[model samples]
Target: MENQTKVTEFILVGFPSHPGSQLLLSVLSSTMYAVTVIGNACMIFIIRTDSKLHTPMYFFLENLSILDICYSSVITPKAALTFSLGKRIISYNDCASQMFFFSLFGTTEAFFLAVMAYDRFTAVCNPLLYKIIMNKRLCVFMVVGSYLSGCINCTIQTGFTFSLSFCGSKEINHFFCDVPAVMYTSCSDTLVNEIVMLALCGSIIVGTALVVFISYGYIIITIVRMPSAESRLKAFSTCSSHMLSVCLFFGTVFFMYAQPGATSSPNKSKAISILYTIVIPMLNPFIYTLRNKEVKESLKKKFKKKGVFFVPLLRMRMTTVSN
Candidate 1:
């Protein structure tokens, strides 16, 4: 026990050296990390300052941006700097902290995405009662519930994960300390840990996914029943951005954690993990901004109010002609 505890750090494996892959990973990781922070931060700023965006939809979006800022900050900073360090080492406790926050924010984002979907349903299918149903108190409650759920999941999984003896290879076969990657280093039995992780993570992913799908199912039905073509188009447009965000995030996350205990190549795992951990955060601002007329309008209003070069902005702003 003393010797195991004395082992304080683990080596993180970078990509195999193949024609500048390491440099590429570093550059790509750094770029994405920067974009994720700036983009999400700007989104939060936009949402906060825009009174027009204080509604439930933008409220949920603000929370989602906050989550994006969080989970990515925990993981991306280290991953971005991996190649710069000669040793590529991380302390044992730090690894556990990283895993804990990553899981917490990731799980919270999952639940919150489901909540966003339901918000959309209420907006589209029950517009008259939307405000009354999705009141401020309820929004706060759902947001708190998602965070509390994530806290519980993180505490349980992180505790179970680090409890196992990790006296084997201190080398983790990935750029960061992920659950599956860290589990690979444990010398003691991880079967139960793996089972717990799978059960909890799978439940969160699958269960929240069902909520999103079911909500969208009703949304689709409602849209279909609408008489006018323009109304149907507008209604579908309202949900499109959320659906895209959902597909990108849930697909990558499901691929990563849904099959815990299953053996796969470290490189394969790392490649897929990048999509959610790195790529999604960077894309989210664009996803919610470019096609979103309201966000663009808000940006226009903001820029116009600040008197920050409005002519070029006016030219670019017309591109998002849809809702």
Candidate 2:
């Protein structure tokens, strides 16, 4: 404990070696970070501004966009700075804060995804009672519940992590202060930490994933029983985008955290982390918009109303002609 107090900061050894590679990575990371912020911001703006999108689905989507923005911001900017400006040191308190927020947002995202799955189930599986089931009060509760659960979970995880005495080197092998990487530096026995991680974190990740899968299973059954092909297609389209996002998020997360630590190569883990932390957020807006005709139409109407339509159309035409 005394030695732990002596340590004031930790060196974040982000993306190990190759200065040239780091520069390239910085450029790419910065570009993705900008896209993530802008794309999610647009989603939020469109959902809020569009009266037609006031349904439960879009409401949950707006929340998801907000989460994506927050979750990515917690890690990406600092990582981009590390790659670009070579600032690799993080204060002990700052590191703990980062871990707490990261875990909070991450856990919230998982629960929110589960709630979104429930929303979809209500919408598709019980269309007649969708409004009654997912009323404003319930929606608000779900969102608030996600945040509260995140706060509780992160508090425990962060407290448990920081309570352990860290000795030897303070070098974290990843771009950000993830639990596994942080624990690796501790001189104290981490069996309890690992067990807690397996029990608490695993329950959150796996439990939410099961909810999503079970919801989708019922959704598929309901969609198949629809009277018309058009209805079936509409139902599938609505859920497909969400399902893809879920798969991308849960797949990468489960890969990183579900297994025992230090078994996978650090570089591989870093690459996976990049996918979930940066690429997924940036891609989510595109995935939801490109696949959903309603969002695209809403966007077109918004842009045309604002007299910004011509620019996007002109760019599209230029790209088409070039191709």
Best model number under TM-score: 2
State how far residue 116 of model 1 sits from its true place (Å): 0.3
Worst 10 residues of 2 by lDDT: 258-267
Model 1 vs truth, CA RMSD: 6.0
Clashing pairs in 1: none
Q: Model 2, which residues run further than 4 Å from truth?
A: 262-265, 308-323
Q: Candidate 1 at 56: error in angstroms? A: 0.5
Which tens-of-lDDT digit does each residue in 1-323 have in candidate 1? Answer: 66568679999986657546767777888888889889999999999988888999999999999899898899887886786544479998899999899989999999999999999999999999999999999999999999999999989988887887877688988888888888877888788877888888899999999999999999999999999999998888778999999999999888888775442557788888888988998999999998688899998888777676776676677865542
lDDT values for all models: 0.87, 0.90
Local error of candidate 1 at residue 16 (angstroms): 2.6
Instruction: Note the residue pairs that clash in candidate 2.
Output: none
TM-score of each candidate? 0.92, 0.93
Best prediction by lDDT? 2
